[model samples]
Target: MAFSQIKVLPTTPLEKLGRVGTNDVYIQKEGSQYTFFYKNIENKEDESIRNFSFKNVENDFENFYKIIIDGFNANPIYDIKLELPNDYVWLHYTKTTSKLGVQFMTTNKVTQSTGISQIMSVEDVKKLFEKI
Candidate 1:
C-alpha cells in the first residue's frame, strides 16, 4: 500500500478542520488524505489524543484506523483490543500521557496490554511508521 507521510497537528476545533463529529470517530477526507479526530472518551478534557492526518492511504489502512477509533469510542483503554493483520502496524496515543506509541503483536507474544510502545512525539511516530 502507498502510505503517505503522516502529519500530526494540534487539537484544532472540529469545525475549523472542516470536520463534523459523528456518534464517534470524527473524520474529514480531502482527496486521498484523511484527518481523524481521535478523542479520549474516558476524559473529555484529555488533550493527549491529538488530531492526525495521513495522505495517500489505502482503503485497508483507513478502515483499520476507523475500527480502532470506534473501539476507543466504545470502550475504555483497557477494554480496547485491536485485531491487526499480519505484519501490519499502527500508531496510537498513550491513554495517560497522550504520547504517541506503536502497536503490533509478534508471533510469539504480545508486547503490551495496550500493545503500545514507550510514549514518543508525533515526529517519532511518523518516523516509525515510515520505517515499517
Candidate 2:
C-alpha cells in the first residue's frame, strides 16, 4: 500500500474498560508498513499479564495468544496491526472445554465477528506466520 493511503480512524468508546472513559487506537500507513494499537489490558507492574511486543506480534499468532493467555489466564482482546494503514483491530482468543479459538473484531461493532484462527497445534500458526 502507498504511504499516502494510510489514515487514522476516529476513536471508539468502550465502557467495559475502567478509569479512562475511552482510549483511542490509531491506524497509519507508510508504504507497506502498517501499524495500529490495542489497549494494554494489564497495568504496568501487573506481571500476571504481559504487553504485546515486537517479539509476540512478530511471532506466530497461536503462540502469541497462548503466551498472552498464560500470562494472566485472562483471554484478552488485543488491539494490534502493523505500520502503514493506521486502523484499530482486535484479536480475541477464547478458551473452551475442547479447544481454544481465535477471532478478529473491532470496537465499533462488537456484535460482528470473524474467525481468523481455530484450535490447532501452535506450530501450525508458526508456519503460516513465516510465509507472511
Candidate 3:
C-alpha cells in the first residue's frame, strides 16, 4: 500500500509548511484544533499524522528548529533525542556525513510509532523551517 492508503488521515484544510526529507511539514486541522505536523508514508501501523504542539507555528517551530539545528552544530556525530513539549512526541536526529536524518516519534504506554523524514543537508533543513 502507498502512503495515501492510510485511513487515519489529517482532518482537512492543510497548510503545507515545506518538506524535510521525505516528510512534508504541514499545519493542518485535526478535528477542532489546528496542528503542526510532519506527514509522510510510514509502513508502520501508526496514526497517519505526527502532530507538534506549537502554540504559534512560526515562532514555536523556529524555536525548536534552532534547538535541533544547534544540537547538530554542537557535535555532528552524536545522535540527539529530544522529547518535545508534547510529552508523547520526540524528535530524533542522526547525522551521516554532512547530512541529517530526522525522525518524528510518538509513544503511548503500550506502543511507539515513528515517521521518518528524508535525509537532508543542514542548510536544506534550515530552509525547510524558514518557510514556516
Q: Using TM-score, give the best candidate's number.
A: 3
Write down the lDDT of every candidate, Cα atoms only. Answer: 0.39, 0.34, 0.55
lDDT of 2: 0.34
TM-score, one value per model: 0.28, 0.28, 0.53
Task: Flag regions of model 2 displaced more than 4 Å.
Answer: 1-85, 107-121
- Error at 112, model 3, angstroms: 5.1
In candidate 1, the residue pairs with backbone N, CA or C atoms under 3 Å apart (3 or more residues apart, or in different chains) clash, namely none
Residues forming the 10-long window of minimal summed lDDT in candidate 2: 15-24
Clashes of each: 0, 18, 2
Clashes of 2: 18
As a TM-score, model 1 comes out at 0.28
Please provide, for model 3 over 31-127, each residue's C-alpha lDDT reduced to its tens digit, 9 standing for 90 to 100.
3344556654465454365655545555665676676677666653454565544535545667667566655555432335545543445665666
Give one digit per residue, the lDDT tens place, for model 1 in 1-132: 754887777753433232223312344556655544443333345433333445544675446545544544443443334333322234443554543333322121243321222333434333333322
- For model 3, the superposed segments whose C-alpha errors exceed 4 Å read 1-15, 21-23, 27-34, 40-47, 57-59, 108-114
Ranking by TM-score: 3, 2, 1
Residue 28 alpha-carbon offset, candidate 2, angstroms: 17
**12 Cα displacement, candidate 3 (Å):** 13
